[model samples]
Target chain A: MITLPDTASPLYEKVKDYILANIGTGRWGKDRKLPSENELVASLGVSRMTVHRALRELTSAGFLIRLQGVGTFIAPPRPQSTLIEINNIAAEIVERGNRHRSEVLVLETIMPTKELALSFEFPKRVSIYHSVVVNFENDLPVQLEERFVNPSLIPDYDKQDFSKTATYDYLMQKTPVTEVEHIISAIPADAETARHLGIDVGACCLFLHRRTWTGAVVATISKLTYAGSRYSLGSRYSPSKSS
Target chain B: MITLPDTASPLYEKVKDYILANIGTGRWGKDRKLPSENELVASLGVSRMTVHRALRELTSAGFLIRLQGVGTFIAPPRPQSTLIEINNIAAEIVERGNRHRSEVLVLETIMPTKELALSFEFPKRVSIYHSVVVNFENDLPVQLEERFVNPSLIPDYDKQDFSKTATYDYLMQKTPVTEVEHIISAIPADAETARHLGIDVGACCLFLHRRTWTGAVVATISKLTYAGSRYSLGSRYSPSKSS
Candidate 1:
C-alpha cells in the first residue's frame, strides 16, 4: 500500500505532487471524490496529519473542494474573462492551450436603419458595417458575437477574413480604442443566439454588451453571448475609495 | 393638434419634452410602441425631420428601442452592479432611491469542518461565524448573501443585527480589507437558493463568489446570488494591455 519512496521534498509536498500528477493525467476526473483520510494514509503510508495537510493545501489552492460532512471533490475549471478590460475571445481560448476558430455567419455592409442610426448617433441614410461571428474553442462554440462598426473608423472592416483574425484584434490594430464599456447580464438564449451557440433556446447565457470608442466617435458596439456552462468572468483587485 | 407654442427651446427639444412629459406621467408605459413618425409630424404640426430627431435622440439615450423596419418601443430599466469593486446590495438599491431591507435567515457560529478549514486556512478544531441573509429592494427579494467570517478578524461577528448592518459593511469597518477576488457565473438556482430568491428551481441566477483578505489571512468568503431578472453587472474602463 505504501507508494511514497521519494524523501527529498516534504511529505505534504510529495503527497500534493502525487495527487496533482494523477489529476494532470486525468486519472482523477472532475468532481471525483478523493479517498478518505484514513484510506489515503493507509495507501500512501503517510500519517493522517500529513494526508490532511496535503488535502487542506490542495483544497485551499482551489484544486479540490471539501464539502463539510461530505467527501472532497474536484472543483470545475473556470475559464475566466476579466471585466476591467476588453477580452478577445480567440486570445483567451488560445492562451489556455486550446484551438480557436470562428464561423463567420454574416459579414457585409448594411444600410443604417433607425436602430443603427440611434446606436451609432449617425444619419440613417448612410451605410455601416455589421457582422455576426461564432467563436469556438476546440470545436465547441462558446461565444456568439454580433458587432456593428462605424465605417469611417475602420474603412475595410468587411473585407478582412474574420476566420484568420479576430475582430477585436483587427479593430485594435486598425485603430486605438480609447474608451470601453462593458455590461454583463444573465439572460435566456434567444433563438438565433441559441442556434449559434448550439444550446437550447431557453438556456441561460452570460451576455456581454461592449461599446468601444476611438476618441469622440463610438467605433464599435458588440453583443457577446456565452453559453452559461462554457465561460465565466473573474477579477481580483484592491478596494479603492472611488471604486 | 398643433400645440407647439413653446418658444424657449428648439423644435426637437420641445418635441422631446412633450414625449418625456407623457412618459413621466405614465402615459407611455415600458415597451409601449410609439406613434409613427408621420403620425407624430401630422399631430404635432412639426416637420418629419423634427420628430425624427427627437425620437433618434431618445433612442440614442436608451429611452427607446428603434427596431429598424418596425416602430420604436420603450427600453427597460436595468439596475446594475459594477464588477471592478465590491458591491454592497443595500447601498446600490438605496442609491437608486429605493428602500432596502434584509431578512435574516441564519446567524450563528459553527464548528469548523474540513470545508471551512480549507477555505479559511484555519484548523477544523476552531469555530467560525456563518450567516445567510436575503436582501430585498422595495420588498422584492433580489439578492441572497451567504457568508463565512474568520472569528479572529471580527470578534463580535455573530452578535451583529445583520438586518440593520450589512455583513460587508460590518466586516470592512471592523478590519480593513486589503484584497478582494470576484468570480462571476450564470448558474441555475438550487432548491435552497431558489427558495430564498423566490424564483423557480433551476431558474437562472447571477452568482458571485467573493473572497476578501485582511493582511495575510483570508477574512471572509461569501456567495451572493442575484435573481437573473432583478440585477445585472456593468463597468466602463479604458483598455489596458493586460486585459
Candidate 2:
C-alpha cells in the first residue's frame, strides 16, 4: 500500500515516485519482492495500465528486476565508479558489499626519465616513487594501478605498506590536492597490464590517466586500467539551468 | 616566448599555464609550431630544465605533439563525448573541427513490443517511431543511433528529415525535456551493428542507453553505440566539497 501525491504530475509518474520512494528509503531492500501490479493498482486507486507503466519504467531504470511468470524483485546493486570524483577502488568495492584486497607488485624509487620529469614538472634525474598495484574484488582482479609519486610531496612514500592502504587513500591523507585532470581512452591491454589483470593480451580495457596537483607542483600521475568486461565508470548530476 | 607570472607557483607550472592559455585562447592554432626550448628559456628568463619540463608535460597532456628532430607542434584535437551532457553527435564532430554527416537506415512507425512498451511506460501495442541512423565524422562511421520515440508526445516524428537534422536536435526543438538518464556499458557488437559501423563482429563497442522525460512521460529511449576504437566518453569537473 502507498499514498499518492496530489500534484500536477501524471497519474503514472505519481505511482512511479511512490515506488521509488519506498526503494530509496530502504523499506523495500535490494532483491526484495515488490507488490504485484494488480495489488498496486488496487491499493493506490490507479488503473492497471498506470501501475504496469510505473513498474516497467522502474525496472528499466535498474531499480527493479522482473522475472517472467514469477514476480518483480529489486535489482542487486552494481559496483560503480564515479566519473567526476576521484574515488578509491577499495571504497567503491566495499560500498557494493564486496570484499576489497590489493597486491603490491612493484614499489620502488627510481630516477625520473625525461618523460616522467616533464609529467611531474620536476627536474630530470630527480628521484621519484613508482608503484604498481592490482586491486581485487572478492579475489577477482578488477583494476591495475600504475602510479608515480613526486618525492618532494610525499617523502616517506616507501615507508607505507600499500597492500593495507590504497595509494589514493594514503595520498589524500598526506597531501591536499588542488586540481585534478582525467583523460579516458579505450585501449587494448599490453602484455604487462594483461598479466596483472588476469586478462588475455590485447583485450579491450578502459584506460584512465589521471594527474593531481598539490599547490603548484604536480603531486601524482597514475594510469588506472580496468577490465572492460568487469568495470564501468558512471556519473549522474543535474545539468545547469542555463544549459 | 612566454611571460612569467608573479605567483607562488613553481616556475615550470607558470610556463605550462602560459602555453596552455595561448592554446586555449586560440592564439596558437592547432598544429602550429611552438618555440624551441632554448628560445622559451631565453624569453621567459627560466632555466632550460624548467622550459623542458613545461614542454614535456604539455605534450603528455595532449596539448602539444612533440617531434624528436623537428619542433613541437600543437596536437590535433580528439573527438570527445561528454559523459554528463546530453550532446548531439553531429555537434560533437563539429566541435572537433570535423565535418558531420549521417545516413538513415531504418525509419518507420513500429508497434511497441512488451519490452518497448515498458521502456516508454506506455500501454503495449501502441505505435511508436523507431529509427536507426549511423553518424559519421567526415564519412567515417562513428556512432550508430537506434532510437524509439513515444508517438503520443511527438506525433510528427516521422515527418522530419533525420539526415539533415539529428533526432536529438529535432526532439529538443519539438519538446522541452525535463529529465535525462544515461546508462553506459561496453559490449561486443553484433553482426548488424558491426556491418553498419564498419567494424568486425565481436569487436568491443561502447553502448549507451539514454532516456529522456518530457513532464512525466518518457519522451524517448535511445541506444547509441560507438566504435570503441574510435570513440570515448569523458568529463572533467571539480568534485564537491563533501564526498
Candidate 3:
C-alpha cells in the first residue's frame, strides 16, 4: 500500500491507514508477517517514530502481536461462537486444571419480594432459598455469586454443603432445566464487593445475571460479578452455508 | 443476612458478605437506602473501619451506588436485550441527533483467500466485495467495521455510497435475510483500529462478528469492533410465554 504522500495528513496516520488498507485488500494476508520498522519507514517515507507508533498501536489493538526481538505478524482472526453458552465459574476454572474453591457466606430461606415474585412467576408469599457464595480461582476471588432458588423445588436445600458443590450442579440433579437467560453488564463494584473480589473499591466488575427455568418451576436467579481483569467473555462466528 | 464470627478472616470481608446477603435477598430492595455507617457498626458490633470497608466495597461492586450527601441505595438490576439484534451504527448515531461520518479506507471487489472463501461459503475462486470503514459518532470514531459481501448477489455494489447508507440497509432491501450467526468477543483493538476508533493503542474492544444468509446465498460477513470504554453490548430476556 502506498503511504506518506506530500499531503496535509499526519505521516503516521497515512502509514497506518495504508497498512490497514493493504491488510484489508489481502496484500498482507492473515498470519503473515509485516515488514520491519526500518523497512516500513523507508517504504512509507515516514520517520521511524511514526512507523513505530503505528506498529505499537496496532499491536495493542489485537491486530498484530509483536514479540520481543521477534518480527511482528498479523494475528489470526478469532472464531466467534453462536451458542448462548453460560458455564459455571467454579466448573470452568476446575476444568482448566486450576484449583477452585468457594466460601459460603449466606444460606437461608426468605420470602419472595414483589420483583422476585414477578420474575419467578411465583406467589409473593412463597419462601425461597438465598445463597451468597464467593468463588475463588487459586485463592483469588474471581466471581461473587448471589443466587435465589425456589426452595419448593430443591427440597432439603439447607442440608447441602455448597462450598464443595455448586447450586447449579445440585439443582440440575434435583430438577430438569427447561429455559435459561444470560445477561452481561459492566459497572463499578461497591466497597463490599471490592473487598470480596480483592479489587479497588471503585473498580468495575463485569456482571452476568442468569435465570434458569425447570419445567413449570423457576429454578434460580443469580447475579455473578467478576473482576473485569480476571475474566473475558468469548464467542465464535461462522457464516452459514445457506442464507 | 447475619454476620457470624470469623475473626481469622478479614474483618471487612465478613462484614461485606453480610451486607451483600441482605441486599441480594431483597432485605434491601432496589433504590432502597442502606443504613448509615454508624448504624451498621453498631448492629454488626464491628469496628467502624470494618463496616466502612464493607460498605465501601459494596458500593463499588454495583451492589450499591453512593450519592453525595444522600445515603447509599441498592442498584437496579442490569438491563438485557434480545439476541443479536443487529442495528446500523451510523443510523443509530444519526437518530441520536449526532452527525455520523465514515472514512472509507478500502472498497474493492477482490477474490477471497482460502479461509475467507470458507468463511463466506463460496468457491475458492469466487470474488467478494470487501470494505474497511471507520464509522464516526459525532466525529469521534467509535466503530471499526470490516466487512465482506458476495459480489454475485450485489453485482453493482460499487455504485452504493456506504457513507450515505449502510450496506446492511441496502442489502436488507435487495435481499431478505433468512439466517444469521452472531459472535461476540472482548478483544484489544489493533493499532490501525485504535487510530480509527481514537482510543488508546491497546484498549479493549467489544467485537460483534456477524454473518448473514439470504436464502442459499451468503450475503455478507462483518466484524464490528467497538471501543470498550465508550460502547457496550446489551440484550434483554423475557420468559417464554405459553399460549
Best by lDDT: 1
lDDT of 3 by residue, B80-182 (tens): 2113223567666787799888878888988888988988877557778998888887788888888898887777776788877776567655654556666
Query: Any runs in candidate 3 off by more than 4 Å, and if so which?
Result: A1-243, B1-86, B91-100
| Quality class of the docking in candidate 2, CAPRI style | incorrect
- What's the TM-score of chain B for every model shown? 0.62, 0.63, 0.62
Q: On TM-score, who's better, 1 or 2?
A: 1
The RMSD of every model to the true structure, in order and in angstroms, is: 25.1, 21.2, 24.1
Clashing pairs in 2: none
User: How do the residues A61-118 of candidate 1 rate in per-residue lDDT, one tens digit apiece?
Assistant: 5677898778877765421222232346787788789999999999999986787678
DockQ of each: 0.23, 0.09, 0.06
Off by over 4 Å in 1: A1-86, A123-125, A239-243, B1-86, B123-125, B239-243
Per-model chain A TM: 0.62, 0.64, 0.62
Return the TM-score for each candidate structure.
0.62, 0.59, 0.46
Kindly report the docking quality category of candidate 3. Answer: incorrect
* Cα distance off (Å), candidate 1, residue B221: 1.2
CA displacement after TM-score superposition, residue B241 of candidate 3 (Å): 3.5
